[model samples]
Target: MENTKSRKQPSTVFAVVSFIAIVAVLIIMINLGVNTTLSVFAGVIMAVIVTALLGIPWKETEKNIISVAADCMPTFLIVIMVGMLVGIWMASGTVPSLMYYGMQIISPKILVPLAFVLCGLTSEFTGTSFGSVATMGLAMVGIASTTSIPIPLVVGAIVSGAWLGDKMSPLSDTTNLASGVSKVGLYDHIHSMMYTTLPAGIVALILFTIAGLHYGGNMDTAQQQLIMNTLADNFHISLILILPCILVILISVFRLPSLLGMGLAVVISTIFGLVFQGVGFVQLMDYAFNGFSIKTGVAIVDPMLNRGGVLSMSELLVTFMIASVMGAIITTSGILDVLAKNVLLKFIKNKSILVLVTLIYCYIVNFLTAGGQTVAIIVTEQTFETTYKDMNISRRVLSRTLEDAGTLSAPIVPWGVATIYVMGVLGCSNAYIPYAWFIFIVPIFSMVCAITGIGMWDADEKPLRTKKA
Candidate 1:
């Protein structure tokens, strides 16, 4: 873990070949329809070969790997904590109450835009699109299914809202990751993203509103009302069920570590489960491990509420481990160093070109990697960190652009994990791609800002004008 930097940099040929090999393994395995964790594991294997080819000893490389992967222990802990929080929230009827009350006031007239807003708020507080999808998104999709509104369009709005909030939320893994990798302040990274994200959010809201008006709420609501009634009868629906959510917002406002915040919040939610839901400590522990399960007699609500638990994130945890190993190998072998300095840097000409190239790389990686934002952000930020510094560009710009391209690209790509997850949860297809307003809008805003030099800050975070020429 100490100064293992004494290893020689891999030659250009070795570096390029190694990089391409790992990328090929990822793209091929992913496209071949293999499990995502397996695909990433293959990439890790390819990484091991790359290190061996470069004559880096396994001992030194292993140490380097552990050193790098250890940095993510906190992130991993946060993920587990989020899982526990989700499970406890469900058991405590917190999520159920939100869905219940949400369905209470939802005017079908504005359901489209309201779905977007509700998903956004849910994702904002929960810090995971998966969490929002499991709770609010499922509820919205259930209501939409009971209506004449297009399911694909509603799913699109839901995806937009989920990712929009995720990109901005401080507790989001991807958001924190982009900032961490680029060495930007978390708040500063979120602030810098406003340039692209703000416009995109507004445009998405307006588009959804127009669609809502066009749809016009012409639906039979007896079933929707029945579902709401079912929720009311089963779960304890009260204003106090929302304390867990309030705790999350307070944690964010206080700018505490997500792992610590989520840990404390999970405890509070566990108490709520015991006090409000009449769950025993052992039963709560079971829920913590295997997720909450309840038979509400409503087909939709049961599945939606059945989603959280530490074990539920097994695939995601494995993917993180694989990503960490692959990333560590790339760093330890020094190939990334050679490629960035000798190859990538040679092509970077100016601010606009740099931003464009970065964005393209991110999107391509995102699509090829099946929409894992962590890998995309890591590779792009590491590849360009020196280039940005050399060009006097702020790292915050890197963080912002990473989200605009990488995070946003996830839900839009048909083969992406995020897109597939959304489709599965919403019981829809790739048809939602055309309607993910916010995800698509940010890229346009990003490109325009790059060309116009708007929001392009210098290394000092000072406003600067870039010559488009």
Candidate 2:
């Protein structure tokens, strides 16, 4: 499908009303306690109706929706594969081994910063904040509970670390989606994010270190030992168990195709599960489809280990489809174009204001859309691409900004899907918001980068463009 330029642009009134109507429906439906899937579907209906009212043909609108959805097919595949990878890694003892070793080495003095770093590493490796939170993040919570450390502080650290992976990981769907929609290379997008991510990470580490030192806990080493023992007793504990993870890292470093790398890694992990865990082929297949389950006779460890599967990704797949439909209709109907040209563009004439406004727009969409990063990134990119081109800025900056704001903002919104899912998994309260230092710091750091033109490129410079989404 071509760009929306060929489509008839609605008048400013029609465009503004259409955009507001969709947003209003989303806000109302979400506030009314409807499920996110339902809320987004309602938004889609509202967008379709608005476009019809604006005199766009239904068939044309449908074509646009289908085109956009097709573009998201790769994302859909990646998410499903991610669910599979998570399940296999768990069944193969890869994740459990990491958790066991991580718990053993994390001293009370470094527990807080270690929590951030460990969760970040897991998330970066897995490429899903929810996965990292559900697995290693839960472990952090368990560790904190056994110590005198504050659960909220640990939860904050986990959230911060999880988002680091979510933003920078090549396996991350949000990272890929942001880079994809912005028409930038995946590694390029990840590389650009380091400008803000690095400094924010350093600052967050300092804060976590200070907080840990001041309010440090008297850790119960016995509980930690128990966790390690239980893991060892239940699964084959070996450094070689993490070969799949190393495989993924190597693939990322080599700059190979992400889906291919992850797909092969999942197969290798499944094989490891069969060989080391001594499960039969049938059981491995079951685990791949329905997720791994661990009883371990230990209530706390069971939840941490028993997660992942192709089925686990179904909700996200549906949610992605719904959000994409709404976005597609908005773009196809030319409402995005109208609003951009008449409304947003009027104020974001300068590059500095453009970056700030884009960041703000990403946040608004993220929260209001209930924390679907794909919708925020794609819609933000689609709405602002022309403006960025007009201002002669690089699309890599746009991709980075999306990661900084859109990808990072999801977990901080108390009611957003990412926050709710992570909190539920880690058993942490929204009070951890103040402590999620990395995600919060990144956007501010990015804004400062924009103001200083630190990582951004001018029109006259080499433009970082890729094949259009």
Candidate 3:
């Protein structure tokens, strides 16, 4: 304790300056066309400088950086596992089968809700919201043209469903990133989010049904049927292909290690590919590492299926490592501690306000960076991490809240990266933004849970303010 007292804490202004400098470097580097890993590394360098200014020695900081990296090793492995699982599952005909069957759910009465479900399932299956938008979303928008339903509403359902699955799916880089940042088990993080996500999903579906039922007549399903036929022609589609996904879910449900589950699924999927798809072992291994590729001769279907590999998700290795350094530096140099004690603890009177501020900051970062969900999640998670601990709130809350605002808010921002891509793919406009109900609905549930203490499980010390009785 005497040795601890010898170290000086950074002042509030210094802490604030350190944070701003890191964020500025990140934003500038990204805008200048730097890759995400390098941008985060730049921010990490800024943090190292701040730590030096705080009078911490270089050796100690280096150790802290390595320790942070080491701590993240499991999550890193899980991310790779997720990627491999996706690739092999695709090769084994799992993903294609899901897509083919999901397309069968569309009917005139529930066209809007079907679009949302189909997009959500596609994204969840393949773990690519952008792909889902380009494929399912494109088809949904095309079919809507033959109906009286508003284009914006169909686009909104597509956007909401795509983002919702991206936010929740284990295969998503963003989801795993959130899990790693908050230091929770991958499945634990996903399960925790269901508190907010499940209800929001239900509400969004109800609204879509109500809005779409009046206009759900005489719609053409030509594009949908074409895509299904393309999938059928390319691969043997079957319900048995769903076992891989079910295996992952059972792993989550039974509280098994995610790595074991993912690895097991990869092995099982490899066997399935051999037995059912007649894919060779060496070729399957190649797909596992490099991702699956196929020429279905369809514009959207090809892009959607040409995804998932260890290399595809390897970019996170550097990004997560560097982002961990940023978190460790600010934490070790007492930057976040100072900021929290002097500022956050003062303004954030209770858990409700704390949760609200986190949600807003996530949105702000996403908006300012024009859809840097990785930046938004990692930065906000680091900034609020220790504060959540101090307030006796779980860090899981921080992860879930960031996802609610960061991931969901991405496509809704008219000029954001996600929205731009969606527009380019579907030829839709900002008219879809207002109808993206899941984005709007989830945050409301997050706030309500904050106020009511519904999902706000206790951590350690009692909070300054208690939840409503």
lDDT winner: 1
Predicted candidate 3 versus true structure: per-residue lDDT over 1-469, tens digit per residue: 5445555678888877876776777668767877766776676677778876766877777787787668667666866776677678778998777666655755656878988998898778656686566456755765565456888899999999999888988888789889998988888789879989999999999999988887786555776677778888888889998787767656645656657867788899999999989999999999998988898878967765776677766655555555666656655777655655576657787789999888877775664444557767877787788878887787778888989897888787544556655654565666899999999999999988888787777675233235651
- Residue 396's lDDT within candidate 3 is 74
Better of 1 and 2 by lDDT: 1
Candidate 1 residue lDDT tens string, 117-233:
988987777677765665577668766755678988888889899988888988888999899988888999999999999988999999999998888468766777776787778
| 231-268: candidate 2 lDDT, tens digit per residue | 89999998899788778767755666668878888889
> Which residue runs of candidate 2 sit more than 4 Å off their true CA positions?
1-21, 28-33, 118-159, 162-195, 211-218, 349-351, 364-403, 406-436, 450-458, 461-469
Q: Residue 168 CA error for candidate 1 (Å)?
A: 4.1
Task: List the candidate 1 regions with Cα displacement exceeding 4 Å.
Answer: 1-17, 118-159, 166-191, 210-220, 361-399, 406-437, 457-469
Provide the TM-score for each candidate, comma-separated.
Answer: 0.79, 0.78, 0.66
Model 2 clash number: 0
Spell out the clash pairs found in candidate 3: none
Displacement of the residue 82 alpha carbon in candidate 1, Å: 2.3
Worst 10 residues of 2 by lDDT: 460-469
